[model samples]
Target: MKKKVIVSVAATVISLSTVIPLNVTNPAPTEAQETQQQPRYMTRAEIPAQYKWKTDHIYSSKARWEADIKKAELLSGVFKKNYQGKLAKSAAILKKALEDYSTLSRIQDKAFVYANLNADVNLTNPDLQAALDRAEKMATAVSENTAWFSPEVVEIPTKQMNKYLQDKSLSAYKYVLSDIIRTKSHTLSQDQEELLAKLSPLSSTGSDVYSRLSTEIKFPKITDSDGKEVQLTQTNFISFMESKDRNVRKQAYEAYYGTLEKFKGSFAQSLSSHVQSHNIRADVRNYKSALEAALIPNDIPVKVYDQLIHSVKKGLPLMHRYMDLKKKMLGVDELHMYDIYTPIVDAEEKYISYEEAQKQVMEGLKPLGDDYAKILKEAFGGGWVDVYSTDDKKSGAYQWGAYDTHPYLLLNYQGTKGDVATIAHELGHAAHSYLSKKEQPYLTSGYATFTAEVASTLNENLLWNSEYKKAKTKAEKMRLLNQRLENFRTTLFRQTQFAEFEKAIHELEQKGESINAATLKKVYGEINKKYYGKRMAADEEIAMEWARIPHFYDHKFYVYQYATSFAASAALSKQLLQQGAPAVKRIKEKFLEAGGSSDPISILKGAGVDMSSSKPIDEAMTVFEETLNELEKLINEK
Candidate 1:
């Protein structure tokens, strides 16, 4: 299982490649994107075609998608009947069964890639929404139909499975089969698996409700520095925080958190029910706990989870020191949670055009050999990215596609330096998918989420080093270093804080304690205090922060990987800088190209960063400490 588990087809609905050939036309950007007087958000229909993804690569028309869905459903029936009771006949038969599963699964993925991407670009489209709704349900059906496959395979004795792994015909599926056998203890009976598969669609109700809350809930409008009324939104909340005016930041912070605060009860229930779903599934599987259950499929040891918290706790003083420096540099009497995100450096606001961003991404990722660079180039030119902000578009960013088509990225790009790093980050993911798809069979094409973030963050580190060398002024250098610091703060510290909170809540529920609104608030507040230390006030409203983090509802035990991956990436990037081409070769061949062929920790170890040890994370913190020391020195320079 990936970090965000693909339990059902609908889950697959939200999920990616090819290259070296360039038969596709790359359109030039629109004049507005190239040169705009004032930046403003555009509706989806208004965005230029060049800036949008060519989903046509997946399906030329709705008829093609529908035809594929119908064919897949029919194929699903035959697949279920043909392999239902026949897998134990021979090794060859088992391989055939698994191949058929991958084939049918790819069919659903293509259908879903088309429908889900369509809905994302224009989230308000009723037609697209209806199509996606059907796709979601179809995904559930596919899961239920094939629910017996794993259990049947798991029923085969481990010795027999080891023999099956030796079969030449099952070479590609060797790891897949071995993994299933390893989970034999956790594997449920066929009927229970089917019932659980059926329950998946229902399990998503809380997630759907949480998703709707982002758009449906009306937030209070706040006044900007210019005395203009502005409605606070997920898209602009952080943007407002970046304002030079403290009042605007405070108002935006209060308005957004205040809105989430009102719905704490609802979010609390949604989150608790969501956590309960995880506990119920884990309990039925006879796993020791929810965290163990979640970690098992990915081959992650519970120690890895505990070690991250343990290691991070040892480094709390560094986090507190950074906060203390932020207060001194900003000359604030008290550091409020809202006071963060304001720039400490004096660099003038700059916007790197989307076209420029693509070039920078190319330059940033060039160290990974020319073949990898070519793949990224194809992703940029081949419309693998849907760039720019638009009305009713999904906020935030992600890379998703089907096995048949190359990876596609969805971003509400706003042309800031941060956005440039984002382009590099996402393209790293797209590049990983391309290499994996080109190298591995469809079944192992997708890398686990544990390993996926490594590629992205490593790119950012490389980009930071390259650009920092080019900084001509102290302020420019300060800005870049500060941005890196924020990554340490946000991706490392903040996510670790989240990891701890999630662990506590799950443990509480496992102990049969109530996880209601009050309990949730109290637990979150306590964790916030510990994470931020005495420097942070642990504002009353900060306790409600968990309410807005959708991953708790969408995927349990997820955020911790953000911290861990950053730690691993920081270590790998250091290796790359020191070792050069050989390091890049190891990264691609051992990590990105490996895909799901091996356990994630082993994959990372092969690439030179061992997650099982505390060294990588501690080394990552060392980078943070060095960065802070540099920033503090710069602040004090005459």
Candidate 2:
């Protein structure tokens, strides 16, 4: 899903899309790196040029970047002077204003991406960081100047708006104009809208504080399986949990969550304030609840959110069955929370180099047909990806770029099976953005977050399926099968668990109940227990887990799409395998290339999955059940 820097316009906020990658980090850290010599990427200078993204393609120098920022500033002033209150005067005026807005938006996006891309690779560089700040400031200023657009457009009479919609000159902006009219009830007067825009920065203060606090946290050190002391970190916590040594996992788990336990009150206060902001905004906007306010703007039905929670709750027995199998496979007396991340079967961990990763991604993605394959080939050596970890390079992976340029990816790639999957996942995002920008206008080129992960997750399914078919041993099959089951577990079940918590807190706040540390922990622990079922030990330390989730602070009600999108892709993957080229055609034309030109549900329906109903969720559950059955049968064999 894309991240947005929201600039309040009326009761609603205008969202500028930012590249937020769904990181498929190395799931199982290799023992070879611990014992053997490995290639070092100590700095950007040491990294080969081929492995670096082509940032020059975006802007060659700081001077050029500065020039665009200056030009954008001038354009924004001119736009405001010329069209501030003139949008509803005539169809021709509205068409020109929108075109100018599009051009300005594109330039601003390019400037922002260039600064952030360079800054991410060289975090220690002050110049790059300054440039990024300047770009961000420019974005905020530009958005503020254009805050009048929505309110003015909505103020137009319905009779006149209909006539304008039929005019060919305004055809490019028809959907946007219609959307504005759709929210007319929610749109405030121009003066009120400007006041809200001015107050927008205060809304994100709690989120900013949380970010600073979390980043500054000092995780306690613990003894590793090697019997040496290692400092725990947010990034490496999960890897430690996957340790073969149960004591190491227990230490890491207790130390990590225990450290979080120290700051529970501060985290609770920050989170409570954010919840208050959501409720206040919803009340001002005339929405029935915070959930409606969040979902309505995206054209998503509240029922879709409800259906996910209901279906997943009904499917919890399957999850309980999974936990029972996990306990049996590990031969443990009791399955504690710490034991969940450790693999139940041992499979060989292979170190795949970046070049090998390229080959695997291309070959694995071949089922999508020639057009999709061609894009994959172009992405490999076309200067699209930064393929290794270097000092001060931002951690994890993501796909991002302006619509005018080819998509760019930043990855701290360590050659594991998970790294190969990351390539496919990020490239799927790149391919989707690439095709959408090529086919659609600037107004609709960016797709909704609701459908964002469908392409990426489907790519993962295709790649893994290709690899699973090639497995020569039972262990390999078990490992990959278990990996798929883990995807369903984390993305579907765990995220729904989060979605439930988010809904509960907002509802509590809406009901005028206090939301503090005690309330949050009580709610999160209960949901976590419910999702994991009775087989889990439901450790007390796990209750503090709510404090560490950055998503809750930054994005509200956003996790459910991870579950919904995963289900959609699972259903689509089955169709791709069974139906072949016809399925590929539908996926490419109706889904990948459609972009925001249509509603997300409509686009998905055109691509052959109907998320508006329960079938996709049910299909995903069936997949999880079957995978578990196959893995259990293998584990039970003499």
Best by TM-score: 1
Each prediction's TM-score against the native?
0.95, 0.91
What digit string (tens of lDDT, one per residue) describes model 2 on residues 230-287?
A: 8787756776888889999999999999988898888988999899999988888889
Badly placed stretches (over 4 Å) of model 2 are 1-46, 122-126, 389-393
Candidate 1 per-residue lDDT, tens place, 483-563, comes to 999989888889999999999999999899989989999999998888778877556888888887868888878778888
Model 1, 281: alpha-carbon shift in Å? 0.3
Largest lDDT belongs to which candidate? 1
Error of 1 at 537 (Å): 3.2
